[model samples]
Target: MSEENKTYTQEQVDKLVQSETDKIRTEYTKQIKELQEKLPPEKDEKEVDLANRLKALEEREKMMDVQDELSKKGFDRELADFIKSGSDIEKLTEILKNNQNYIPDKHKGTETTITKEQFKAMGYSERAKIYNENPELYKKLSQ
Candidate 1:
């Protein structure tokens, strides 16, 4: 039939329009997909920022936990940063126990009192030893 003479029913006209629309839609979809593949994947700024914040918060929590554990174990909480044992409290405790000797003891014994006359009688080496041990006491005695 001649195209000009051809008459399409409503159903036929609807089908033709639908088929063309589908083809155009498919072609545009394919083009969009291809362009997307060629371009770098976009990073969601808010998601990345949230992930970083979460990581920081997790680290802070872990550090605080370690400090609390240190305090409970009678170790200096300041040692939390120096602890190599990640989350293993047992290993941390063992390490602290083994190296307990290295940690300074804050408890001081009664200070030995010496009269100025006794200080004067001390040799240079003795005075030097006392000075090295307690400079304040040495200064007091020396004066």
Candidate 2:
């Protein structure tokens, strides 16, 4: 005896494909749910997003506060960002305290000039010599 092979109609083939697709989808969904259950409870998406935003805002606020405090203490604008990033307020304060109103030793005695009253008391030759040496100073004092 010989057996004959049977061919499936297009509609039957489509139904069979649809059933397999549905079965695979159901299995995948079940596996995904099981994996999710194995993990710890998660925060809501909105809550997680808001928390991250809040943290960033707090950091920005802290940076601004540091900048303000440094500026008020007369630190140079060029070094503000470096000091703010480093976040060492005490070091900044120490630098400001040590360097405030600093004048180098070389600049100490270079401002000598005779006033009009002092020049008037000097001898005629001395006045002429002083005027010749620094005419600009003499002119300023004479006024």
Candidate 3:
């Protein structure tokens, strides 16, 4: 039959369409697989968020433990924020010992008599120092 006059039967046309559809589908599937292989595997959002929150909580717990250690060692609790030893009490103690000169003495020389006016005029650190050295004197002055 002439090419112009040739016509595909219903079965032949359906087969042709199916073959073309299969090729296109296969090509798209291969491309999707290749792209997936090239990219890093994605983590679930909920899992990632949970991991971050757990990390934060662990850090906070370490900090709290360090601060408790500092208080136990007669150092200021506030110093825990500055310390980066992460929960190693011995390391923290060694650090404090090495930097003892920088840290104020909790107990200095004998307490001297100061009036209420003088105590009131003293800054927080000075007052804290006096209180640390002698609670009775601090109470008397404060009263």
Residue-by-residue lDDT tens digits, candidate 1, 29-142 = 999999999998786999889989999999899899888887887778898878745456668778768997774557756567788999999999999999999899899999
Q: How well does each candidate superpose onto the true structure, as a TM-score? A: 0.39, 0.44, 0.42
lDDT of model number 1: 0.86
How many Å off is the CA of 61 in candidate 1? Answer: 0.5
Q: Rank the candidates by TM-score, best first.
A: 2, 3, 1
Task: Candidate 3: give its CA RMSD in angstroms.
Answer: 12.1
Query: What do the candidate models score in CA lDDT, each in turn?
Result: 0.86, 0.79, 0.87
Q: Whose TM-score is higher: candidate 2's or candidate 3's?
A: 2
Clashes, model 3: 0
